[model samples]
Target: MITLVRTNDIVLISLIEALLREARVPLFVADAHVSAVEGSIGAFPRRVMVPEDHAAQARRLLRDAGLGAELAPSPGGS
Candidate 1:
């Protein structure tokens, strides 16, 4: 899996999840429980990940949604 976005904003995360779901892009939220364990104090930012093969498309989906700034930098520095 490739990391797409890492953020402490739950609302933004929810929005991203909804958008991805609507687009039929499979995603996994890592550190979700960790954030809850941290008392949702905006620490332990959660991560949204998708299959490696879908990373580019997922990034594009997010970018087109005006969430490009939220994206994790590509390993190649894109």
Candidate 2:
């Protein structure tokens, strides 16, 4: 999996999740339960991830939706 976005903003994560779902892109949210363990202090940022094969398309989708600034750098540095 590749990290597409990582942040403490739950709203942004939800919005991105919806966008990805609407576009039919598979995704997984990492560290989502950390908040429960950490009392919602927001220290651990949740991560949005997609399969390696779908990273580029997912990044493009988020970028087009005015979320380019939230995108994580690709593993290959592209």
Candidate 3:
């Protein structure tokens, strides 16, 4: 899986999850358990990831949804 976004904003994460689900793209919320364990501190943010094969489509979908700025930098800094 490739991470598309990491954030402490539960609202943003929910929005992304909704978008991914509606589009039928696979979604994973990493570090969610960690956040729960940590009591939702601003540390150890939750990550939104998609399957590698769907990453481009997911990224495009998110960017179109006005979330480009929230996207993680592409691997290799591209």
Candidate 4:
């Protein structure tokens, strides 16, 4: 799991998720409960995870959407 992006902005999360999904990149939602708890308090941090193999693809897909840069190297990759 990695924190690809963080923001107290609720709309951004949904937008990013939808964009990623539309691009055929599956992402795991993390700290979702926290987001609800904080109610976007000063920007709640959310975690998004993908398999090691899909990590790079995920990053690229997100970047292409103008989300943010890749956070880390995938420990598992081709």
Candidate 5:
């Protein structure tokens, strides 16, 4: 099964998705809800999923894009 990860914002989400695509990471849409933070109704809050194997690499890619911090995963999950 695929795993879903949240992007901080719609623009960041799109950027990360595009970058992931360019990197050849397989993607799937899990959810794409609107975020109230953007306050435009359809402003943001989209989420996406990739194959489980690619999750780490996806987070690393986002970290590389300056979206979030990357560290070794904790004992339980990937």
Candidate 6:
């Protein structure tokens, strides 16, 4: 899997999750539970990830949803 977005904004995370789920893209939100260890002070951001096979489609889907700016930088040098 590859990360597509990472942030402390739960709203944004939820939006991405819903979008991906609706599109049937494989999804995983890593570090989602780390807030418990960090006292939910926004110390650790959650990550939105998709299977490598879905990466391109997921990125396009998110961009179409106006979340292009929120995407993690493409893996350096491809």
Candidate 1 per-residue lDDT, tens place, 1-78, comes to: 988999988899999999999989999999999899989578699999998888888899999999999999986789
In candidate 3, which residue pairs get closer than 3 Å at backbone N, Cα or C atoms, i.e. clash? none
Each prediction's RMSD over C-alphas, in Å, is 1.0, 1.0, 1.1, 3.6, 4.7, 1.4
lDDT of 5 at 64: 82
Better-scoring candidate (TM-score), 1 or 4: 1
Off by over 4 Å in 5: 1-4, 33-44, 69-78
**TM-score of predicted model 5?**
0.60
Tens digits of per-residue lDDT for model 3 on 1-78? 989999989999999999999999999999998887888568889999998899889999999999999999877575
Quality of model 5 by C-alpha lDDT: 0.62
Q: Poorest 10 consecutive residues of model 2 by lDDT?
A: 34-43
What does candidate 2's lDDT look like per residue over 1-78, in tens digits? 999999889899999999999989999999989855886678889999999998988999988999999999999887
C-alpha lDDT of all candidate models, in order: 0.91, 0.91, 0.92, 0.65, 0.62, 0.89
- In candidate 4, how many Å is residue 50 off? 1.8
Error of 2 at 25 (Å): 0.4
lDDT of 6 by residue, 18-77 (tens): 999999998999997885578768888889999888999999999999999999987753
Candidate 6: Cα lDDT at 13: 91
Question: RMSD in Å for candidate 1, one decimal?
Answer: 1.0
lDDT of 5 by residue, 1-78 (tens): 344455445665677679889999888654453355556655454557777788777767767877664223422464
List the candidates' TM-scores in order: 0.93, 0.93, 0.93, 0.65, 0.60, 0.90
Measured by TM-score, how close is model 3 to the native structure? 0.93
Better of 1 and 5 by lDDT: 1
- Candidate 1 stretches with Cα past 4 Å from truth are none
Backbone collision tally, model 4: 1
